[model samples]
Target: MMIPLAPATIAAPFARYSHGVEVPAGWRLAVCSGQLGMASDGTVPESPREQADCCFANIAAILAEAQMTLTDIVRINAYVTDRAHMQGYMDSRDAHVGTPPPASTLMIVSGFTRPEFKVEIEVIAAAP
Candidate 1:
């Protein structure tokens, strides 16, 4: 199982995330690579919200395939090409993951491997 942590001495997280996460030893884990806004057929969406939706969907699909779910995720790393897209990222993410969310980091990047790519998300999850 994973436990999200945010101590009183630390600043509260800016969004739907925790400051740290704890996963006990011996639990099965999955570390996902950066997932872009590509559909299963390799099509990239133009809108940031659409892309964010696709990104989380892809992440969820990966976890599902491994017999896990979003609730099991411990850490999340999000990268976006522009600051303007952050709202969409946060909104989409909050829609997918539940309360006391995983420890997370969000970055604004200059660009991506593909110019059309607006966001990339990476995740680490532990089995219960």
Candidate 2:
């Protein structure tokens, strides 16, 4: 099992995520490419929350190909086009991640390749 690290010397995480995670030896790792908010049907949602949901769904599918699931995720890197979309992204993340939540970071970017895209997510997972 992975170990969550939250040092007492530091402040608690600002959101539903761990500050770090320790993947044990002998576990296999999967690094997924960043996933955009577009659905397989080639449609992008107008709302940030919806877009983020799509992004996580895509990530889940990618992990499934490797015989893993969202609970195996150890880290997440996410980007949003605007600060206003942060809450929306966070909500989706909280819904999908497993207990003791993975270490995470969210950033605001100028934009994506597509103007309509509001969120993108990538993750690192490990499983024995």
Candidate 3:
């Protein structure tokens, strides 16, 4: 399980977010490369939300390939071209993760491998 690390004083106020913490022991760790919004047939979606969905879907598929789920993710690195769409992506992510969300870093980049593509996501998972 992902444990939030923080002193009692610091963590009380920021209970919504986990304190800097450590990954549990004996868990299988997997580092996934940045997944673009390309479909299985190499089609990139035009909408940012669509792309973000596709990217996360691709990530989920990859994690499943290794017998993992989103709950096993400890960290997520998200790259998006538009800031307006970031919240949507986060919402989608929350929908996927449900509870005990992973630590995530969201970035706004200038462009991507495909101009139509709007988001890419990379993840690190620790399986218990």
Q: Which candidate number maximizes TM-score?
A: 2
Q: Report residue 25 deviation for candidate 2 (angstroms).
A: 0.6
**Candidate 2 segments exceeding 4 Å error:** none
Q: Please give, for residues 1-128, the per-residue lDDT of candidate 3 as tens digits.
A: 78756576653522222434468778888899998878888887777677777877888888998899877778888898888878767766776662466767788999886687778889888877
Which candidate would rank higher by lDDT, 1 or 2?
2
- What do the candidate models score in CA lDDT, each in turn? 0.88, 0.95, 0.75
Model 3 reaches what TM-score against the true structure? 0.84
* Candidate number achieving the greatest lDDT relative to the actual structure: 2
Off by over 4 Å in 1: none
lDDT of 2 by residue, 11-74 (tens): 9999999999999999999999999999999999999999999998999999999999999999
Whole-model alpha-carbon lDDT for candidate 2 = 0.95
Per-candidate TM-score against the hidden true structure: 0.93, 0.98, 0.84
**Tens-digit lDDT string for candidate 1 (14-74):** 8789899888888999898899998998899898878988988898999998898888888
Write down the worst ten-residue block by lDDT for model 3: 11-20
Poorest lDDT segment (10 consecutive residues) of candidate 1: 1-10
Candidate number that wins on TM-score, 1 or 3:
1
- Can you rank all candidates by TM-score, best first? 2, 1, 3
